[model samples]
Target chain A: MAITVRIPTPLRTLTGGADEVHAEGATVGAIIEQLEANHPGIKERICDDKGNVRRFVNVFLNDEDIRFLDGLQSPVKDGDTLSVVPAIAGG
Target chain B: MSGETPPWVKGALRIEAAVLRQVEADALACYPSEACGFLFGPADDPPLLDEMRREDNEADKYHRLDPETFPRTSKMYFKINELRAVRALEEGAASGRPLKVIYHSHCDAGAYFSQEDAATFASGGTLMWPCAFLVVSVIDGEVRDRKLHVHVPGTNGFRESPLTVIE
Candidate 1:
């Protein structure tokens, strides 16, 4: 499945300044892998060394948390939008 | 009005790298000591990590310490404010988000809330007796650790609990 993923500005360096990226995958993990394959270093920012999502970040699928869903294995159909928003700690 | 929890925070505690980065940057600007402040929630949403709003830090002249030795502490305290408690309640209602938590920083200490923090929470003059509190500790301009605490209304005062951010 091809889906559109939105990346925040802070991680834009890893994505070469691209605000949005497209990847093909069946699960969230696969989509992440595709993102990493296309843009090296992107995965490290989103995933930890053990391949788990970092606590400092949250992945929302259409405004709903992925954790309440299937987590990284959550399935994405075509045309779905995935928003990766890191919690903003700035005052 | 609290005993344990209402199950909402069972899986709602966590921060983001972007948030951490900003917090660290702000804390670094006042390095060599702690940078304390408050985090407000979104105008419409539930109390969660995503809803934090940083308020002004306490004032320096009020620091009760020698100003010459702790300049950062003085200037930093100058930035603190006694936030309008009603703003948090009204915003929570208008935005559907509640007073998620209060956040501060520690210069060289671990990211843990001190006894004074507990006393403040138990005071119950703010939004609620039970609320979330977060602390970020920086050393040499680097964030060494972070901690979150949840205060609950208790028999005499508010009870404190530790919050863990799970990956």
Candidate 2:
């Protein structure tokens, strides 16, 4: 399945300045791996050493949080859109 | 290094009087809990405050997700709703007035950037928005202090910036 991944500005450097890109996968994790294969160093920014989404990163599958769904295992298909948003915090 | 104003500040951070009042009121109304919002303005030197957009502080969501590691409550910190943030960014882009500042309140604490704040805002040594941050300190339903800081490129950190309230 082909999916469109929206890359936020902070991770644009690894994407050759492209704001969005297409990758093929059956699940969000697989899509991320495809992205890594195409754009090196991008996965480290989104996932931690344990291969889990970073604490400050939010992955949305068509405006719905993946964490609320099946997390990285969330299923995807052709034309699905995934957004990687960095969590903003302050005190 | 210790002075009323930091010497590294290029100029005073100018904000509109009405906008400041609104931010102060929003912070006061969200008493004991942190409040967050976005500021829009021109992309010029010392950006002007054209408008303020307030969003809910969804820190409780994290507390419920993992109370042990994310121990902070809604009364301590803030997490801007991701959906709301995305909408705001899209609106800002469509209007040609990008997000110029991010404002939040610190309950019962001085207006200083915490380590977590630095890590989140300046993650990967790059700021999501090349704008300033406004930290408003509120105590007992009153505004105590407010400070502005801007990221120092290549330093991987932020520096105190002077603020000037314009009428």
Which runs in model 2 stand beyond 4 Å of their true positions?
B1-11, B42-46
lDDT of 1 at B12: 47
| Chain B TM, per prediction | 0.65, 0.85
TM-score winner: 2
Write candidate 1's Cα lDDT for A43-86 as tens digits: 88778798876534557676565755888999998988776755
Q: Provide i-RMS per model in Å.
A: 15.3, 8.5
Fnat per model, in the order given? 0.00, 0.68
- Residue A23 of model 1: what lDDT? 87
List residue ranges in candidate 1 displaced over 4 A. A1-91, B1-12, B40-47, B64-80, B123-130, B155-167
- Models 1 onward score TM values of 0.47, 0.90
